[model samples]
Target chain A: MRVLALESATRTGSLALVDYVGAPLGAPLNGVRQAAPLREITLDASLQHSEKLMPALIEMLGAEFKIETIDLFAVDHGPGSFTGLRVGMALMKGFAFASRASEASGKPLIGVSSLEALAMNGSGLVVPMIDAHRGQVYTAVYEVGAALRDRRKSLWDGRPKLIEPEQAIEPEKWLKYLVEKYGSVPRLEDNQIHARNVAFLAALEFGRGAAATRPGACHRHAPTLFSMTPRYLRAGV
Target chain B: MFILGIETSCDETAAAVLTDQPLRILSNVIASQNEVHEPYGGIVPELASRRHMEKILPVIQEALDKAQIKLSDLEGIAVTVMPGLVGSLLVGLQVAKGMAATLGIPFVGVSHLEGHLQAPLLEHPEVSYPFMALLVSGGHTLLYHVKEFAKYELIGGTRDDAAGEAFDKVAKILGLGYPGGPLIDKLAHQGNPKAIKFPKGKIKDHPFDFSFSGLKTAVANYVKKIEGGITPSLLADLCASFQETVVDDLIGKTVLAAKEKGIKTIIVSGGVACNSRLRAKLPEAFFPSPLLCTDNAAMIAAVGYHSLKKGKTSPWSLNAMANQDVRFC
Candidate 1:
């Protein structure tokens, strides 16, 4: 079974294809970091996501991997870029909808939380930090749940929060936030944007048969998408 | 004819199956992700879109299954494709489009806000045209002069931050919690709304295009001053106070607008519409069904049915939109 995954939660968008055979993707796919159970499609942090996302996906679907043979689909739900999420979700929904339109068997869409995806990159104390404007950040702390044979386990320990830049008690606070919050903190290595983690969570969910499932919501079953904006829960939307 | 409907304008992932000629909901399954969003205090678009993706198929399945209908059992699929979160919007649009094509059923897109505007019909059934409609939600707060099913005259709306957004931000600043509307609604039940007279901004007889940003900031500054720290009761009082002002303005403007337009029927919906306080305070001149006050897929389906009957089906290539100022006609 081939798995088509899309990650638009962050500035560096990613798409990965995984197959039961082996590596789910091939070269000619730009932004592709690692290949295999996880193939990362990286992009410029500043480039237009709409411009390159489809072309790369078509390549992966047509030449790199056979999308027709996929059994399920996966995508990221955000704690990342607002515009990116919209673009990515729209595309994923389009592609998935197209598949269903052809009288093909419907593939349940898998949604992995972006925060959880960031946590999957194997850090003992992983902080999946997304930049919220001002001197604040959206963060969820995690303890590695399980480690991949080749990669690291992306997991978190507690609920996410929108805290002042100074509130990040972890390491260097990305340094950028350090000076804004405190006088000066030693610079720590910037975390390489692990875009593939989005697909990994989807693959992980598929491994556990968690596709097309609903996450618990307060107040009468959460009422669908109208109540799902994480930022709405933050100090402000 | 039986119809399936999909609504993904903002945050709620909704699917409702209903009848066309006579509007009636068969199965309405809405999958909400409020808690996943609770911690952050505001919707993370990425999170919301992901939740939509996860819930879209199941919501459709449940709606269809509840109605005891398969894809082929339906005659048409109606979806909302306008005026919403582009990402969240796409999930519902693409899903509905796909279903229509697969089921060999025609599908059409409905305006997300217009769905709420028409919600009064589901309850009143006899609501006449040329009525006054005030739509309040997290994404929008507007006053419209409704002359017919498809004709609306823009009268007033918030200059900054929708009424619902104001409630959410105020509630959060007061540490009320994730969704401020309902919490504020609950707390307002105990507090004296008249205790604090929050500002009801008037644009000098403009009669339309309301302003809540001033009120929102007013409450924020007031709360910061009174307790010197955000507290529950203070938050509750702020909610009550702010709610009253909004209600006063909404009801006042709506009543006057109704009188001027020679129509009588004030309808409300959106996340903020779910507020019980406003529901009780909206006055008898408006829609009374509390259920009709909140956003739901039934309204979307109803609007979609109207579109279908009018042969206003969107081409399969139709794109999801994010702007509220949409002109489908």
Candidate 2:
């Protein structure tokens, strides 16, 4: 299966196309394997995602791969810049809709949580923090087990266990609470949301049969082109 | 040529399909966020953007469905990209670009103001070039000398609040509902326009420029003075007087520009053009239907039809501008 993933939930947006082979249904959880993207482009922070996204995609899809050739579309939905999230989701929705129209079938669309995707950057007691502005950060704590780390060579092996549900809170208050609970907090890393991670995570989900098998079979748990929306944890003003 | 138009510049999530060669509107769909922003007494940018994200696709799909056309049938796409909330504009822009890229069709980024200017052409195709346009809406109040399609020379504009913004503010002050233009217009009919002689907005030296902040304040002060003794009759009178002043201000500047430019044709458009008092007063001028008057996609597609004919297409790098002037090229 081919997956075209987009990560535009932050200033630095990226796009990646990964080719993966899904494991047989009911196979072992870590059976799916993904190759590095056939093409990848990380956009410069100088331009907004709206300005750079299409141009980059056009260049990547130039004469080599048509949009329809990609089997599935993935995007990092929200918990980051509200506008960025919408731009990414809107573009993905457009592509997915076009794909569906051309094939006359359901084009599976996977939405990865921006915070959860960020957690994949680290292992073991991971706390991914995205600068939510307004002196607050969108964050969540996840416990990445050693078993998942051992199989990281393949697909993003296992879903991180949620230690704390995602939220928007002050960094100082969150850090103070973390110190009292775990003695020493995990290393804080800068936000580096990559589309490759989004693709890998979506590939894992597809292998686990989270996607629909037939046309118009999308349910609440599975997101379709029409059903995907940004996960803006913070309420609008 | 069949063109798809998308507009999410403000509280309205609108889409339409238009075809040229004897221009006609196949479908114009709009999903308004009035109820979402009604509690805030005004449009909150974040909320508007959020609502637009939720409704953009369904609205576009409806537009195509109502027109009985498929996405592949569209030859071009046009979307409002400037003079709007950045978050809201991005939602529409990205979708338009995505569809265009996927279909391998050309798309153009339209200015919101330009979309309003082309609205008259959808109905009054007889209204020729070199006409004067008075655009009055929640976001802007400006007069333009439209030499031709995509050729515009800005003449005058509001210095403080847009004419429709003033209406909304005054409506809020009067304890009226949101979108003050229609509310005040409906109430004004029951009361006498001569009941309260409100001061007309005037600018020094710049006779065509408008300043409605003074008028908004004056209405607020009057309502405060009569705080305890308010009645429906008094509220009607207040709405009537305020609407009269705005209509007068809009007409005064528009007429001045028309006379100075020797332009006989006047096109009135935008949200405030729905005001009955304005429509009743400016009977000679061309006014689009109430649906066309407000922010809708048909006008944008109309502009796109003309623009695409001229081989004017935007690059994929085109980005949304929160505050960009109308481009004549």
Candidate 3:
């Protein structure tokens, strides 16, 4: 089973594949996690993509990794880059749905939060923040308890707000939100989250059955790609 | 099944086949109309579009045969629809749609620019997203932060004529004929790039935006002053001077963009991307594979693979997008 994952919501994005030795990924075969091997490329604005993604997949399948057997696909729904979100999600949904249809009716597909995954493997309180423009950021807070098997994913009850430097709450808001929402308390003071940390959380959640129960997690079928929208925290501010 | 991709965005009429289980390209055929347009200095879209319709079907047939596949074996169809000449784009889109409809399969409309960006990996197979790309074509000049596969940010773009357009215009002014880049490039090697004190429009602080109009006009005015007594050596000098300015502007903005964003990889593409000067002067810090240039359906088809891998399929309404219709300038 070949499990290919795509995360394209940040400046330094990542792609991973979980290779299981079988007809498809997750079908009771030996498996191992591998980063989808990416060749270094010079990127420019007008260098249109229509050819970018599929070739790499083809290369993988042809030489070493076979794709017809990709049993599970993991995609990162973003709190990072907006265009990446639309492009990546559109592609992810398409692939997942295709895989799900071809599956033997028992397999499930899913969407993973890029930020959450980036925060998962962290050593301390994971405060994942993605630049949200206009001096704002898309951020989430998470804190672990000792190590894996005892970790937690924090939630917020209120609407995700865009706070400026002046309106920003003290770092304690992470703990405050956790306490108010999940009623769990954090033990850390200042801990910054990185991408790998987010990826780790995503992996853990998928492993522990904490995420999407179906492929093409999006409930909507039609996604527009030609529009460029500015994702901001403050609405009509 | 065989998937034939037809692309005639500018000077190139390209056809490629996506075949078999892994969707590997069997035959990638591109018949560049650069020479035909070179005498005109710049591609006249009307002529280009007309030529595309004339040669498109043959190119398709050639690709199908080269791939050792037949139309009967083709399951679906794909064509580049947008961000290019409406006239040129229609030729490919119409052909693909016609073929698909006739064959009773789904038609996938691809963005032409996406085709260029996705070209290199057809053979190399290692290129992926989270990189930067500079698409420099006769009709377009822009910078994109390829934040992910098939996802692009319009970080910077040409405010006026694209790099290739400027090359053609400058080449014509110097009496070097049309499709000016190769001519200018060859002439540049014969003359000194520093011969003319041409200006490189430094939109200092614009970050990624570029403007080559001023330089193009400067070279034209220089030629006008010569009053038709254009010397061969002088033309070479002028071509070198103009080419130098264009290359500087392109490389400067691209390198600066990569540096500012801390992006490590940068790929320069498009017909103008095939320019020798740009191929030489583009700062090596960003682009390591300097030859990963040129406009081909191979890239578009490769990009198609990434889009599919990322799961980016289009509905029937997704038409070929024009440059004006694209998200960013």
Candidate 4:
């Protein structure tokens, strides 16, 4: 199965295509958790996600891959740039819905938290932080080590969970929460989220069957074409 | 040929379907967010974009459904991609691009200003080219000498606040709430336009240029100086006076531009073109329907249809420009 993942929760938005080995009929395939990405393209959009994303993704896929080959669509939803998330979600929804005209059923859409995706960039206890403007950061804490004792258990089968929910808060408070959770804080440089990391985490989610669930745990939600909306945490007054 | 147009440049999430050979509009649906932003007394950009994200998909689907066409029937897709809120523009543009790609059809990014330019053509297909166009809207106020399709020369424009924006601001000063254009227009009918005299702003030696910031300030000062502090009666006079000043400047400058360019035919478009005063004053000029006067996608698709015929299609790399001069294209 192939998953087309989009990450536009920040200025630097990107899309990736990851292929997963389907489970055998009798027994689960039980492949390694972090499968290598097949193709990944990162966009240094500088807040130009809507204009640069579609063209970049089409060029990245080229003519070799058909649109039907995409079994799942994923996006790094919310807690980042509000416009960025909307553009990414709209593109994902459009692709998912339009492709349904030809296939037996529409492809599944997977939305992952940008903060959590950032934490997946490295091993060990991770506290991902994104500059959310207004002198605050959109931060979340995650324990992304190989928590599962069995290697056959997928990493995204809900093993590594979010230690703290994502929220926009002051730097001092964010640091305090991180310190309280994990004895000491990790380096600030390690918490940076990348588009490639978004693809990698989405691949884990797809392999774990979390993509098929209606509403999974760990801030992951599968959205239909009509019900999809960006996770705008800072939405009202 | 069938085309789909999506417009989210501002508060209106609009979508339309147009067929070719005569450029007939099959469907035009708009989901306006006026009520959502009414409490603020003006459009809030962030709030506007948020509403666009929520309504864009359903709006497009409804447009297709109303046209009695399926997604596969569309030969092309057009979206307003410039000269408005970037966040709002992105929502429509990205979706159009994705749909076009999925359907294996071509999609083009139409300029918002160009969409205004072509709006008259939708209703007045018999109208020819080489005419002066007065585009007055919340975000823009300009005069253009359009020689032909894709040939636009900007002659005059507002120096400060756009004409419609000034109306909105002045209306707020009188407690008229958000979108002062229609309300002020209604009240101006009851009160005498000559009740209070307001200065018409014009630059020295620049006959076609306009400045409404001073006029807006003058209204603000007058309202503050009134002995009773702006009663309903006083508000009516103020709306009438302010509307008169704006309408005179707009008509006066546009007439001068037309005469100077030696063009007899004039076209008025955009949101402010729906004003009763302008409509009554410029009977000769072609004005789009009241529905088309505000932002809509039918005009965008109309312009896109012609643009695509001319072999002009924006690539997927087309970025949304917030402040692009219409003449440069």
Candidate 5:
């Protein structure tokens, strides 16, 4: 199976193409210890999501993989750059809708959260801070679970879970709130939504049969088209 | 050659398919969000963007179906990519890029203002070059000296609010509701234009520049001074007086610009061109039909047809611009 992931929730944007090796349908290896992607490609797009994203995807498809071989598409639906999110959503939606016939895995598009994708890199209490400017930051907290050792454990059901819902707040106030709640502020990192992590998470969900339902917007839970909108936190005036 | 045009610059999600040989509009479909924005009195940018996402795909399909063509039949795809609400503009731009790549056809980004300027050419093939264009819409009011396709020179523009915006403001002040142009035009016909003397608000030094804010304020103050608080007769009189002043100002400046440039032909377009008063008053000038007057993809397709002929095409990296100066391509 082949999965393509696009990450443009922040100033920096990226696209990842993964070649997955599937095990037998009923095999224990299919549970959590599935095959890793054979080939992964990520490009730095930084603030040029509109200009660089599509051409890069074209180049990747032409040079590396066939468009028809791709089974699913993923994008980091943002609480980040407003323009960046729109560009990413539009491009992915266009791809999903356009390729609906040739590549029919039912729902082909999945939106990975930038915060959750960033949190995938850290082990402890991970807080991903996306600079919202105006002294405000869009931050989310997650608690990393133990590594999956057997078929009994899954990432979403037993592993990483959101501790605090994402919100746009003052950086100082967010830190203070975190300190008051957790007794200490967790380490903050600007991972900038790596496409590799996004692809990893998306493939795990696909393996767990999340793609059986309708594709969620830019998040993991909801399965509606309206959810694909950019989570700017504040509405346009 | 067949070209598909998509426009989602503001509240309207429009698409059109046209043939290049004779420049015929096979299909021009527009899904307007007037009712959605009616409650807000004016457009809410976020709401408009949300609506565009939902309507864009279906609207394009309808345009293609109405044109009796398939996606594979299109020679190229053209879209308005600039001088619009950024969020709304992105939907159309991204969709067009996707179509161009999938269909293996050329893609070009047309300016929203340029789309309006080229509208008359779609309906009236006889109207040729070197004509002055008076483009008036809710967001803009400008006089352009068009030497030819991709060669536009802006001679005059609004100093304050645009002419269509002035109508909308006056309508709100009079409780006429959203999209005040057509309603005010209808009411103005029942009343006398000479009933109230509103200021023309023309620029003093700049011979053809316009300023409608002061005129709008004058109407507001007049309404405030009325003893009975805007009766039917008073409303009609105000609408008539205001419409007359706006129409007179638009015509005077357009004619002045034409005379200054020694050009006889004038092409009036944009949303305000649909106004009955403007059309009735300026019968000599060329005007697109009512549907073409408002924001639609047909005009963008017209500009696209011309752009393609000139061998001008945009790369995949073309980004949306919120404000593009009105000039040649």
Candidate 6:
């Protein structure tokens, strides 16, 4: 199965195209190795996503691969830039709509959490933080199991269990809470969420038939289009 | 040629499919966010954006389905890309870009104001150019001298509140519901338009320019000064009086501009063009049907059809602009 994933929750968004072997429902995780994207491009942060996203995708795909060639579409639904998330999702939804119209059956769409995609950068007691502005950050703490850790690759193998749910809080208060709970938190480095990680995570879900039957999956069983709203954790306007 | 038009400039998520040769609208779908925004008594930009994201695709699909055409059959796409809420505009603009890119078809990013200008052309194709256009909406109140397709010259505009905005603010003060234009128009018919003397908005040096902030403030002051609050009868009078002043200001300025420019034909459009009083007073002027008067994709598609025929297409890098003057090109 081929997955076209987009990460536009932040200013510096990225796109990746990955190929993975499909697995049946409730498949075991024995030989499903994480595959890297065949092509990936990081967009310029200075330009707006509306200006750079589609053009970049067109150039990246070129004549080699049309949009219809991709089996599944994945996007980083956000706790990042609200406009960026909507722009990215709208673009993917448009492509999915067109692809579905052309084919007999529709394409599957998956929405990956922006914070969770960032969590892939760390292992064992991972805290992924995204600047939520207004002197706050959108963050979540994850307990990455040792079995999922791979010494060779930068990204971890399996899903990181959510120890602390996502929330938008001040950096100082969040750190204070983490230190009190976990005691002696590891030194963390700020990292951008790459589309390759998004694609990899989505591939894992797609392999498990999550796109077909998962509770929050955009499309389940049928290949019809659904409204996949951005995850803006901040309530109200 | 079959063209698809998308508009999410503000609270309305609208889409339409049209054929350019005979200028026939196959399907025009508008998913209004009035219910979502009615609680706030005005449009909240963030909420508008959220609703737009949810309805954008479905609305477009419904338009295509009603048109009885496949997405692949569309020759081109047109989308409103400017002079609106940036977040709301981006939803439609990005979707258009993606669909066009996927289908390998050309698309144009039309201005919201330009779409309003092209609206009259859909209903009255014989209406010649070099006409004066009065575009009155919640977002804008302006007079333009339209020389030809894609050509517009700004003649007059509001100094503060737009005409539709004044109606909304006045309606809020009057304890009326949101989208004050239609509500006020309905009530105004039952009351005397001359019941209360509301001052017409005027700018000192700029004769054609309007200033409705003062009028809105005047209505607020009047409502507050009332001893027994407002009765239904009084409310109708207030609605009538307020509507009278706004319609007078709009018609007066448009007529002045038309006479000054020696332009006989006048085209009235945008949300406020749905006002009964405005339409009744401007009998000689060309006004599109109530559906076309408001924000809809049919107007955008009309503009797109003409633009594409002239070989004008937006680049892949076309971005949604929050504020831009009407493009003369």
- Candidate 5's displacement at residue A89, Å, is 0.7
| Model 4, global lDDT | 0.81
lDDT of 3 by residue, B1-329 (tens): 55666677666788888864555778778888876665554567766755664566567768877989766576556667776766577556645543453344555667777776665445444555666788887778878888875577887888888888888777777666776777888888888888999887756677688888998888878877886697888877887888888888788888878788898777877777667778767545233233335555655665555555455556533444556544434
Candidate 6 structure quality by residue, lDDT tens digits, A29-97: 335566767889998755388888877887888866677777778888888988889999999888877
Q: Interface-residue RMSD per candidate? A: 6.5, 1.1, 14.4, 1.6, 2.8, 1.2
**Model 5 chain A, TM-score vs. native:** 0.80
**Model 2, docking class:** medium
* Segments of candidate 2 deviating more than 4 angstroms: A21-30, A149-158, A179-183, A188-191, A210-220, B224-228, B326-329
Could you tell me the TM-score of candidate 6? 0.92
Tell how far residue A214 is off in model 5, in angstroms: 11
At residue B83, give the lDDT of candidate 1: 81
**DockQ for model 4?**
0.54
Greater DockQ among 4 and 5 belongs to: 4
What tens-digit string does per-residue lDDT give for candidate 2 at A110-213? 78888888887787888999889999999999877576657665655667767899999999999999999987679747468878789877766665664434
Off by over 4 Å in 6: A21-30, A149-157, A188-190, A210-224, B326-329
Candidates 1 and 5, the one with greater TM-score: 5
TM-score of chain A of each: 0.62, 0.86, 0.53, 0.83, 0.80, 0.85
Per-candidate DockQ vs. reference: 0.08, 0.69, 0.01, 0.54, 0.35, 0.69
Off by over 4 Å in 3: A1-237, B19-24, B32-50, B102-104, B226-228, B283-294, B317-321
User: How well does candidate 4 score on lDDT at residue A35?
Assistant: 49
lDDT per residue (tens digit) for residues A42-149 in model 5: 556767778888887787667444455666677777788877877887777766655543433333567667888888667668888888888898888987645432
Worst 10 residues of 5 chain A by lDDT: A23-32
Q: Flag clash pairs in model 4.
A: none
Per-prediction backbone clash count: 43, 0, 64, 0, 0, 0
lDDT of 2 at A169: 95
